[model samples]
Target: MIDRRGFLRLGAVGGGAVFMSGLYGKAMAAAGYEDFYFVQLSDSHWGYKGPANPEAQNTLRRAVESVNALAVQPDFIVFTGDLTHTTDDAAERRRRMGEFKQIVGGLKVKDVHFLAGEHDASLDNGAAFHEFFGPSNYSFDHKGVHFIAVDNVSDPGARIGEAQLAWLKADLDKQAKDARIVVLTHRPLFDLAPKWDWATRDGEQAMALLMPYSNVTVFYGHIHQENHHMSGHIAHHAAKSLIFPLPAPGSQDKRTPLPWDPAAPGKGLGFREVEAEAKPVAYQITEFPAMKG
Candidate 1:
């Protein structure tokens, strides 16, 4: 349902990348807003050790350096999910989480946000993740936009669950019908590829709750590549992973990381910048390599 005008891929400007939607333009126009932008880095899988990415230990650090190199730093930065690789050992999990935090600490921007991916949360119901980061699901406001971070990974079944659904409903009830809304989650609310664990089990209910709001955009990760989709008037954009990329939805028999291309080491791994303009209600998304040439 992605409106034809909802997404415009403005690829690689001055060695960066960006995206914008028609809906964002309209919402900004109605909100009496000020221009602002944020950085989104997803699926770093910080503790991973594998051939999929030989330089796993340095990828996240490179990403941080890339952001630090931005001519104008974003107001804030957010890691959508998979901040760490999964571990059955509880102590090891905590250690990875701690180390991951310390690495991202190099960012020039002090205001950073986090969300949980299944690898970081599904094992112990987000206990380790919560211990390092704060609550997984919450809301905040900036420059006339309402942002909600929903925790679907915490439930193990990939469900937002009934309790959080009530919370979402209550939160939405407080906003104006035209409030500009941004949803950040680890999984797609719509059924992108159910067998691959890409869709939230009860995401439709969550979408129903958000549908009444006229201005809404969703940013997510878990797919490990840049994907754009529309759910009615709402636009969902998936971010690129800092670790490795996966095959496009259902393009292959199995959901596995694409082999790392030694010839192009950083090919499928990167981060993005979202710049929002107030006067015209426009936005531009710019992407950067996790490791620069």
Candidate 2:
């Protein structure tokens, strides 16, 4: 059952209320009875140094601090992608990744999962990213949930390709019919915006691979904002960035980073907290800047 109070707080933001409330209620109600709770934080862009966010250096630190400070520590943390900004120098990339590690160094948690974004992978097709992080795509089983991480950013176009698809099928075949499945990627499976190359080229194939599952949820990053759409029984969700926000699809003729409003500088760094087990629970997204201000 949805938490009426929490849903109302999330709904006050506008169109996001219904979806946000529904997800929270559904996840929370299944918490202890179903699965574990985990937090997703994306697009930290650790190397991004700019005045748009004066506290850029400390922003990530603060965000990690907030996560650590949570009364209920999540089972794990998933950083969807964009660990660093685009860079040609290998040393620079290493430095950025190192900084990210430093920020989360004190966190009292276990199991951190990472995915690579186009910015982090496109430069050299994830050569540096993989060296620091592990395999670009992989899967693991926790409790009754089958978690699949797909690599869409490091290629000619955003695609899972044939090798990964085959692995996905073989992996799914091993799980039971009632098992819950969750997929993580840097790009949405649907054509969110073809012009910006935001949509994945082989996403349809990836979706087909997952269609056989009874319960599935796909989580992505890259749009730097939150969006939810239902395709069949599968729920697709995009997370907010820890660095900056982007204009909604078609909201602007050309996509560009939105300027930080002086009155709401830290607004973009907010994130969603999800408990995805059997009975899931999530908090009303607390906008850090708004709350701190």
Candidate 3:
């Protein structure tokens, strides 16, 4: 049921994350035209080592292979964030970023975008991340759809802050009221749970700015699982992580990594596909459970 395939039908489920289906198809699209689809990967946490994910490097490699092997090529691929695990040593961080980029460069998809997660922000307020991936916040338009990526995690307080908000407003101001907008960032724009470091301190301001748009959807990562929520007309969807899945928000007293289970090695981990050309965007998600090796 989780891997349903089709287009134009989207369900907005509740409880912290969003789940969507119908992003990838095996058969060729009808001649003369085709729908738009792109793959979303998040929380790769490269350079991480521990029992939580004993085979971290291989998992990342397999993830690339999985996307490359998709029967139909995704229009593009966007990594939501946490590309590298936290490393305090400046040189080490650069090394990790270089390696992460090198590995990801192997992806068959040519157009790839990256975002910065908290771990990536650990060094110099993400100066290192910028050094590796370029600007922390920006936007682009593709096939009449506007995509915006915000940096809400780098701030020590976990805030989108004022400058970026102004940039977002100016960017939105250029678009027509009916324009279709997709927001990409490292964390949810709404307060899923502030106590758990899950909510962006100033996200509400950003949400308020997007309210007037006729069609707006947010695809973000950080929760490390599938979640969906609606803010008025806008929909916010969360994607699963490649490195490891975190506990569901507020599910436990303390935020801790879900123990890597040999029996369910790939559970709660996967990628999402979005059908952007459809009237109402439809998405399909796949979770990878770790396996016994």
Candidate 4:
């Protein structure tokens, strides 16, 4: 079922590809493992009008087209967060979310997932986000992997809160200690750069609950770039933004959006394609440019 042609074509356009995995290997597939993949588009920042990205309005629409053009459509699509830029008007917020929803609705794939970012939720504790997209935090089982969508941005404090932690604990207790688990969030769980508002306040607790599990990987967004790091045994990978790119963690005093390069318009803007192999429990992540320079 692997469409080699489509995969190659996508890679040819987008470029950077990286591979990540856990300790779980071939033995994990004894129970009928199935390989699957998904698309992750983050930080679209719809309705954002700034010099950082003049193509802000068209960027997301273009990304949708890019995914639709994929030779092999992913099993599902997930928007990590920051779907819209921050707004002071609640009505404007909802309007932006509405418009964002309508645009993405053009996708060929019917099953798409969304999460909240501080811009979309922190203002009113995810009130408008809930009106458009249900439950900020939830979990699901796909093939043989357990996917947990954590809502750290819902609380303006950047904390997952005690309640969600309890829920996560309860959920983890049900799965086998060695379950292949993937945690998706808008903010990096570990402290990547606290001054930049990239770290989750109580993310350590969530990691603690997941620590007992042997196979665990996390995919998050917020910093707006491709970054790879490890917290003990857990591996955290950050996704690029569909909007604009941010400076590396602590690289500069202020976490300002990098100046748009006239030479390469879409240089730092893109999405991700994650191919999951159940047998070896590996994730082949390919980063694709939202728009070519």
Best by lDDT: 4
Candidate RMSDs in Å, in order, are 4.5, 4.5, 6.0, 1.9
Expressed as tens digits, the lDDT of each residue in 110-188 for candidate 1 is 8999999999999999999999999999999998888999999999999999999999999999998877788999999
Q: What TM-score, computed on C-alpha atoms, does each candidate reach?
A: 0.93, 0.84, 0.86, 0.95
Candidate 4: give the clashing pairs.
Answer: none
Model 4 agreement with the true structure over 88-135: per-residue lDDT tens digits: 999999999999999999999989999999999999999999999999
Please report, in order, the local distance difference test score of every candidate based on alpha carbons: 0.87, 0.73, 0.78, 0.88
TM-score result, candidate 3? 0.86
Better of 3 and 4 by TM-score: 4
Model 1, residue 129: what's the lDDT?
92
Distance (Å) between predicted and true CA of 49, model 1? 0.7
- Evaluate residue 127 in candidate 2 and report its C-alpha lDDT on the 0 to 100 scale: 86
Which candidate, 1 or 2, would have the higher lDDT against the true structure?
A: 1
Residues 1-293 of candidate 2 have per-residue lDDT tens digits of 56534444453453133243222233334443444556788888888878656667777777787777665676787889887887788788888887777776767786888999987887788888888888989998775567899999888577778988898888888875545778989988888888877799999998887877666788888888888878887788888888888889778788788887777777665665665534443223332221222
Better of 2 and 4 by lDDT: 4
lDDT of 2 at 283: 25
Which portions of model 2 miss their true places by more than 4 Å?
1-33, 277-293
